[model samples]
Every structure is written in C-alpha cells, then in structure tokens.
Target: MQEITTIGLDIAKSVFQVHGIDAFGAVIVRRQLRRSQVLPFFRKLSGCVIGIEACATAHHWARELEKVGHEVRLMPPRYVKPYVKRNKNDAADAEAICEAVQRPTMRFVPIKSPEQQSVLMLHRTRQLFIRQRTALINAIRAHLAEFGIVAGIGRHGVEKLLDLITRGEDERIPPAAHACLMALAAQLAMVKRQILEADRRLLAWRRTSKTSKRLEAIPGVGPLIATALVASIPDPNVFRSGRDLSAWIGLVPKQSSTGGKERLGSITKAGNRYLRSLLVVGALSVIRRAKQLGYTRHPWLVRLMERRSVKIAAIALANKIARIAWAMMAHNESYRTPLPASA
Candidate 1:
C-alpha cells in the first residue's frame, strides 16, 4: 500500500528478497516472499520500476512484472557483481541490483520471449544429446578395440559399428559386453533420431519466423546460424553496430592497450559459445566447398586463402558472416552480397 520509487528483487528458486526505496532514497520496504506469494505481493504494490539481474528465468519474471504495470530492467550479471559489498548475501545482492539499474551507462539485458527460449532450448537439448552420444561411441570403440575391432572414428564409423553390433556378427564377443554395446548403440540411435527431430522443428519454426528467414537468406547461414542468431540476441539495439554483435559473440580479436601502444590477440572467446561454434562450423563448410568446387577463384576467397591457411580463413569468414547476420537483423533487410567492380 506504499509508493515505492525503485525495487530490487533477488530471485531464487524458492524464496525472493524485495528491497524497496522511496523518492528521497530512504529504505521504505524490505520483505521476503515465498515463490507462491511473490507475484501477489508485486501485484499489490504501487506500480514502480523493478530491477533484477539478467540471470536465469529473469526474462520470464520481467514479463510477468511488466503485466502488473511495473517497468523492469534486467542488469547484466557482470555489471551487478561489482556493486556487491564485502558481505555477499541476498539482501546485499538485492541492494546492489537496486543501485546498478539506475545508472544510465548500465546496459540491461533485453528480455527474451518465450518462443525465443523454446527454439533455443531445442538447440541446447540437441547439443547435450550429441555430446552424450559422442562419448558413448568413443567408449564403445575403445572397448571393442581391445578385441581387434576398431571403429574408424567418424559418425559413419559409429553408424557402421552399431550395424555390426546389432547384426550379432561377433558371436565370440562376451555376452555382457555385447549387451552393453547393443544398449549404447540403441541409445545412440535414439539420440540421432532426436537430433534430427529437433532439426525438423527448428526448420519448421524458421519457416514461420521472419527474422530466421531473413538470416537464412545469407549464403552460409543454414538452420544452425539462423536459429543461433535469433535465439542468442534478445535485442539488436544492444549492439551499436553489426561489428559489435560479432565482437560480443567472440568473433573479434582481444586487445591490450598501454602508453601509446596497442596489441591485439586472438578472438576473445567470450559470450554465447554455441552461437560462435555454429558460425565457425557454417563458415568452415563454406570455405571447404569453395576450395573443392573451384569457388576459390572468387577474389575474396582467393585473397583470403592466399593470406592464411584454410582453417584461419574459415574463422575470419565466420566472423564476417556473424557481423553480416547482425546487420541483416538490425536493418530488417535481406543480405546484400558485394558485387565485382565495373569493368
């Protein structure tokens, strides 16, 4: 029933802390609420600005709070970290979030929509399953190698191994080991099927999503790049330019500055790991095909390949592709490839 000027919320799985202050910067309210009671408490409060760290589940909370007529700002966790006092606790974090949100220089995270999260989740689940399947395949291959059977070390190799195991070609194999191998092979097949299904869902979602469709129009951006870009970036404005987007995705080089001197290193390797990886893979494929299909005769590819190894060229190209993808998203235009100069 009180007029709260600003509120800092420290959200957790079960309990939450609400730190409230008034116009003159006086602490007016400090209360702890259970998960079930948190929303009702906010609904009853006078509409005010709510500050929360841009953490897990923050967007969902941000949208929920907005519906109650309160403005929500989600601060990046790194920015909020410097504000925490010596004694770090819920209340301290809540208070720190309170101070961080009011700064004009602070960059707040753009709240992701539920649909965005859903599409991203498919990618994440597929990544997890792929990792598991890879580990299992390696183990199966290693175990079989002890008995003079070897998997040649590729997806196709794993597939063939599974076929050999399923057909029971090795009757001399121990029953227990055969059982384990068969089980692993079956699970690996399941995971492959799931990954394919996820790809199907992503492709379907891309068909209906304008942003993904536009991104996919770019030369190298297939389902992976299209989905990764849309899912990872919640706001295009957060990046001042496409270069900034690429840099944020760790495509840009790291730098160190001293007195009148500057040195640059390899890519910073910060930000969304999955998106960076997808971009790298897409770019590598493009580079490989360009070499094999004689597209290397193209000026850019020729000059790039001449300057560095194919692997390095692929990474640089990937970096440029990421920037271009951002530009496409920000400008709401289809990709415009560069044309050769007039004769």
Candidate 2:
C-alpha cells in the first residue's frame, strides 16, 4: 500500500468522514470514523496534509490535528463547494475538500488561537445582549403607546417609561399590562448589566494586547473596533496588500465587468459582517465629528462630503479605514496621518 500524502476530513457531532490520497493522487483511504475513534486512527497514520472546512468546531479539530504533527489547512466551505463532483454527501464533500486543498489557487482560512476565539465570543455575546435589550425597549414602548402613554425618543424617553413602570402609579396602565412591563423592565436592566460586564471584560483584555492598543491609534477605531480587528485577523501578512484586506472585509465595490465594459455596484459585503459594521459605524462617527467641527485634516474626506451623500461617504471612508488598519497590522506600525497635498 502506498503512503497517504493528503487527507480531507469531514467533521460532525458524532461521526467524521475521511478521504485520503497517496502521492500519486490515488485513493488510499475512504471511511467514516466514530468521534471517539478519530484521534487513534490519525495517530496510526504517518503525518500528512489535512484539509478541513472552516466551520463550527473546525478550528478545535485543526489544532488537535496539528498537535499530532499533521499539517492542517482550513478552507472556506464555499471555496470547496466547486470541487464537489456531484451528489452532496459526507463522502463527496470529503473528496472535494481533498481536491481543493491541493489547488495552488485555493484560499485557506488562518487558524485562530483560542484567545482570539474567546475574544470573538465576548463580542458575539455582547451583541446578543444588546439586541435583546433593543427588543425589550421596543416592546415596552409599543405596549405603552397603545394606552396613549408615549415618551420622547432616546435615553431620556426610555427613562421616563421606566420611571412610570416602577412607580406603578400611572392610571393609564392596567394592572395586567403594568405587571408585564415590570417583567420586561427587569429583563432590560439585567441585559444592560450583562452588556456593561461584557464591555468591562473586553476592555480588560484589550489593555493586555499591544496590537489592540496600537490599533486604537487609528482614527475612527476605538477600543471596541480595535480589539475586534486584532482578534479577528490572526495573520495580517496573509493579505498581499492593504487593498486585499479591504476586499476581504467586504469594503470593495462589487464588480460585474464583462467584455470591455466595467460595471460596479455596492460593496460585496462578503466577509465578516461584524467587522464591516464596526468600520462603517466608526466612519460615521468620524464624519459626524468632522461636520460638527466644520473641518477635518483629510481634505479628501472634505471633498467627498461636498459631493457624495453622507452615507455613501461613510462607506468610502470605511473602506479607506479598513485599508489603513490592514497596513498598520501588516507592518507593525502606528497610524500615520497623510500630509496635505501641496497646492
């Protein structure tokens, strides 16, 4: 039997399918292994290249396989989809992954460290609580509106509603409705506390990371965005240029060019939605500050605001910010302000 040189592992909750090929591209093994049998099976085989789809638990398996002296490469599932000959099944998917891993042009996902994963989890949890808080606030407002009791917009308005709920003296609210509102208010307060705790933990983690601290120097990138970018991008050098990073973050315009004509539409929005949203929100903050101050150091942004809508300008600024962030991370340098053009 020839020695296997490459393998594709399709992982699941309790079962995993493995397809392996020898140096000459001949199938050497194709079988399903129970969850408990996976490690022992790999231990008996010689070290080889392994391909895994970047999905839930993929990183954990990749790290484990690497610890066993195998070279693990994680590819986005979408990129491997094209290699599937037909009939999507665990066996077929494993075969496709095996083929895709050997392609020189195929892009692979960088394995994230446990710490990075933890920080991301923090971000996700905080976001979840924030959404829940918003829902609670909206529900409370809607319920109160039915009784002809309305508060103004923003925190002051929300406070007014909360005061009414706690006082339990508003004749407008029926006892039943007041009880429900009290329950929602309690949940909202609890979620708010959770969000604040998440923020505190995130900030604590950020202070320990020099990269996150350095990223904070970039305009429009606060501790939240800085920490997110640092945790999300494990290796900035994987990107050939700042533009590549921007494109990966889905800040680039979508292209539909054909023949000799060029057509472009909105941003592809293909990559990390969280990062994209953070950058855009940060950009909007910068724009708002610039408008209020009646000036900005970047003349380009000034010109952009003069012609383009604020939202469009915000997107463009976000793209530029993403590129700047990539350059800083890739080069291990601080953000440098570009000098104004000589008239």
Candidate 3:
C-alpha cells in the first residue's frame, strides 16, 4: 500500500468525504465516513498532513486533528475552486482541497482558538438582535403609516409610535390591526433589551482585553470597533505589513493598472463587511469632528481634505486607521498619535 501522505477532507453535517494521496501524488484512499466514524478512522491512520476548506466546522476539526499529531492546513474555498478537475461534488472538492493544500503559494487561514470564536459569536449574536430590532421598527412604522399615523424618524420617534400603539387611543387603528401592531411592538421591546444586554457584554469584554483597550486609544476606534477587531483578527502577524492588513480589510482602492498606466477606482470592499462598515463609521465620526474644528488639530487630515472630497478623505483616513491598528497589534504597542512637526 502506498503510504498516504496527504488527506483532503470535505466536511458536512452528517457525513464526510476524504481523498488521500501518497507522496508520489497517486490516489491511495478515496472514502466516505459518517460523522461518528470520522475521528476513529483518522485515529487509525499514522499522522499525516490534512487539508480542509476554511468553513463551518473546519477550525474545530483542525484542532481535533492537531491534537493527535496531524499537520492540518485550511485553505479558503475560493482558492481551491480552480483545482477541481471535472464536476463540483464532494469528491471533486475533496480532491481540489488536496491539491491546493500542497501548493507552495496557497494561503492558509489561521486556526482560531475556542476563546476567539466565542468572542466572535458574541459579536454575531449582538448584530443579529440589532438587525431584528431594525426590521421590527420598520414594520411597525409601515403599518402605522397605512392608517395616516406617522411618527418622526429615529429611535425616539419609534418610542412615540410604540406609545401610540400601546395606548390604543387612536380610533383609526382597528382593533385587529392594533392587536397585531402591539405584538410586533412587544417583540421590538424584547429585541431592544437583548441588544442592550449584548452591548453590556461587549463592553465588559472591551474592558478586560488589553489589546482592545489599546485599540480604543486610536482616534476613530471606540469600544465597539476595538473589541470587534480583537475578536475578528486572530493573528495580526499573518500579514507581512500594515498595508497588507488594510488590504485584507478591503480598505484599499480597487486598481486596474495595465501597460504602465495606473487606473484606480472605488475600494475593493472584498473583506469583512461588518468590520469595514464599523471602521468607515468610525472614520466618519472622526471626519465630523475634524470638520467642525477646521482640521487644525489634524494637519495631515486637513491636507487630505484639501485634495479629496470629505467622503473620500474619510475612507483614506479609515485605511490609515486600519494600518495603524495593525501596527499596534503587530508591535504589542498602544496607539499614540504622531504629533505634527513644528515649523
């Protein structure tokens, strides 16, 4: 039997498919296993390099495999796509993973620890509740609008609308309609409470994490952004430089340069949308303050504002903030704004 040197695992909820190859790249093991049998099968094999797509259960399996002395490498699913020979099925994906994992230039995702994943879960849960709250608010507003009842815009306005729904004083709203709106209103209240609790938990995390605290010292970063970045980015050193980190966040401009002429356009917007949005919001906050104060305090920002529109300047500042944040994490240093040189 050819010694199985590499195994590509395509993981699913109930079953898993595996394609194993020998040192000379010959197919040695092509098999499927139930979820319950996966660990036992791998335990029988000698320690070998395992490759899996970086999705759903990949991190958990990576940790499990590494415990038994196997070298596990996870590749982004997109990077493995080109390796598929014919069809896109479990076997083909497993084969692609096997091939991609061995490529010298293939990038691997950092295996996140349980703690890091837990923190990310908190962020995700909070975001979910917040979104639910927004949808509920919009529903309530739309329903009220049908009866010529309209509240002002914003959370305070939502409160006014809720009060009207709760009081049941408006004769225009039929009893059946009132009951339905009240139910939605009740749900909205519950979601709001959940969101507030989530915020408290995130704040607690922000207070305890030293790196998160350091991130908060940056101009645009608040507790939310600070804690979020700490949770999302498991290893800053994965990137070779701060610019790479910024690019990874998709804060850099999209470029189409050919034949020595450079063409640049809007941001790539390729990476974590949540993180990018938070950073852009933070940048907008900074820009608002800078605009009000005439940018005297941030001379560099002033010069940037002169060259570009306020929105573009804000994005550029956000890119800088991302780079600065990467530097802070990479160096284990706190953020300290560089002072303008004296004339």
Candidate 4:
C-alpha cells in the first residue's frame, strides 16, 4: 500500500519550498521551485495531501492544486507560526505548515473562489483610493494653512475647499498658495472619480450576486457592505453559531480568566478590521436614525442604552447585526428578525 504522505508549501513571490516526509516522518522531498516551475512540478507529481500557510496567492494555488487531485489545506498564519523552529526559513516554514495541517485542532481558511476574490479586489482598491484622497485633502489644507486657511475632512470638504481656492474668496489665501491648492484639488478630484467608479462597478456586481442580495436584505446592510461581507466570509459553516460570527468580527468582548475568576474586557479585535469598522458605522447610523424617529423595545438595546453609553449600545447593535448576518448566510435564508426578549 502506498503511504498517504503530506507535503507543505512555503510560498514566496518568485521562489517556493516544498517539504514532505515518508511514512516514518523522514524527510523524503525538500525541493525548491520557482513560481513558474511550481505548478508544473505539482502537475507531474502523484496526488497527495498538501498544506500551505494562508497568505497571498495561497487561494489561487490551492484551487489549482486541488484541480490536480491533491488535497490542499490552508492553515492560518498564526497556526503555522507556532510550528516554526528557532531559525525561520522557507524549508522549515514549509515543514511547519505540513506538521500543522496534521494537528487535530488545526483551523483552515477556505479557499476563496475567483468571484469572491474579484469582489475583494474592488473593496481593497476603493479603500486605497479613499485613503489617497484624504491624504491629498490634508496636504492641500496644510499647505494653504501656512496663509491661514483651514479645510475640513471629507470629499465634500474637498470640493468646497477647491471652490474657495479657485474663486479667491478667502482673504487669508494668497495667489501662489491657491495655485498649489488647485493642483492638489485636481488630484483629490481624480481620486474621488476613481473611487466612485470602483464603487459603482462593485455595486453592479453585488446586485447580481445571490449571497450579496441575501445579505443586503438586512437593515443597515447596503450593497457595498453586503458584497464585502460575502467576499470576506467564504464559508459560514466554519462558525459553530451566530454568536461566533460576532466574535469573529471583533464585536464580542475579550475574556481573561484565571483560578476560577473570569473577566470580560474590550473586544478581541482579532478579525478583519475593515468589516468590523463597517458594521460599527452601520450600527451607529441605525441608532442615530432610530432616535430621531422612534425607538423599539429591544430588550438588549434598552439594557445596553440604560446601563452603558450610546457607543456601547451601538456596538451591541453591531454585534447583533453580525450574528444576524451569520445566521442568514449559514442557513441560506433571508433575514429573520426574531422578537426581542422581554424588557
């Protein structure tokens, strides 16, 4: 009977390391292959179990290797990090990945499909352009403030500042500074245009996506948020329950317990920062809007608001929303707002 050996892949930009052992855990193959050579090498080899650290290009390679009849598993970076010996190198890292994959407690990241990746690309690019636009606005404001000009933070503020600069409406602003401001304003406008274009395209894509549509059915979750969530959460079943979804999004408190004493602190903040941030923002909007209109007797929200600050209430709402999202996605159903517990 042929041994069901395992192989570890340490991925890099140009070079890669492959570590494998025989039935007795003896190093049978320690090979180096270039990026172009990696796929072809695997194509020629017999089907076996392969492990790789979850990072850039891991998903693509995992999908490709799986297509070739190999069982590919991707372990999170932290899981593989523990197995790395004193001196970390490609070969040792590859070996560690292999060892980690065999652990009973090991957790794996689901390989994202190309469509999921495409949606994520849109979100990443939009974030980058927004950041650049903000920087440009700040730079313009700082440069002009040398002559006593102040610009607020926002895309709208960019337009207003540009109008002020080009129109020479400000007595404190000089002509030379206005010239520099105009160029900076142009850059800001360009970035805004790029962001808008990307957002439009992303929304269009989200509109047709079944997952995004289901997510969007929930309140406070628009197309952008829905699409981003679907992309980030490729496999919802990995989470045991809806609460785990909130915890995964950093919406749950951190726990520190010792000697039969337990204390819950601030959020773990361990998962995707972008998704957490979006949820928090959405929660805040819901609360603010609710106040101006009318508040429902949601027991959790009532207790949270009375005992804690509005910020805490907002976070609780976000946590609930995260759980709701998980339930909807995991169960493959639309949002179901269960009745609030007794107040």
Predicted structure 4: lDDT: 0.84
Whole-model lDDT per candidate? 0.85, 0.94, 0.90, 0.84
Q: Candidate 4: how large is its RMSD?
A: 2.3
Question: lDDT per residue, candidate 2, 189-287, as tens digits?
Answer: 999999999999999999999989988888799999999999999999988998888888899999999998999999999889999999999999998
Candidate 2 Cα misplacement greater than 4 A, ranges: none
Q: Which candidate is the best by lDDT?
A: 2
Highest TM-score against the true fold, candidate: 2
TM-score each candidate: 0.93, 0.98, 0.96, 0.92
Q: Which residue pairs of candidate 1 clash?
A: none
lDDT (C-alpha) at residue 258 in model 1: 93
Q: Report the poorest 10 consecutive residues by lDDT, candidate 2.
A: 290-299
Decide which is better by TM-score, 1 or 3: 3
lDDT string for model 3 (1-343, tens) is 9789999999999879999999999999998999999989889888999999989989999999998889999887878999999968999989989999999998788898898888788889989998898899999999999999998998789999999999999999999999999899999989889989988988987878999999989999999899888888889998899888787789999999999999999999876788898999999999998778777778888888878998898889899999999999999998787887799
Residue 149 displacement in candidate 1 (angstroms): 1.0
lDDT digits (tens) for residues 1-343 of candidate 1:
4479899999999989999998877898887889999889999887898999988889899999999999999887888999888799999999998888878898777888998899889889989988987788888898888778876767788777778899887866788989988888888778889889988888888888788888887767897779878887877978899888877788888999899898988889887788889888888888777767887335686788887988778778889898888788888889876886566
Clashes of each: 0, 0, 0, 0
lDDT of 3: 0.90
User: Among all windows of ten consecutive residues in candidate 4, which has the lowest summed lDDT?
Assistant: 294-303
What is the Cα-based TM-score of model 2? 0.98
Of the pair 1 and 2, which is ahead by TM-score?
2
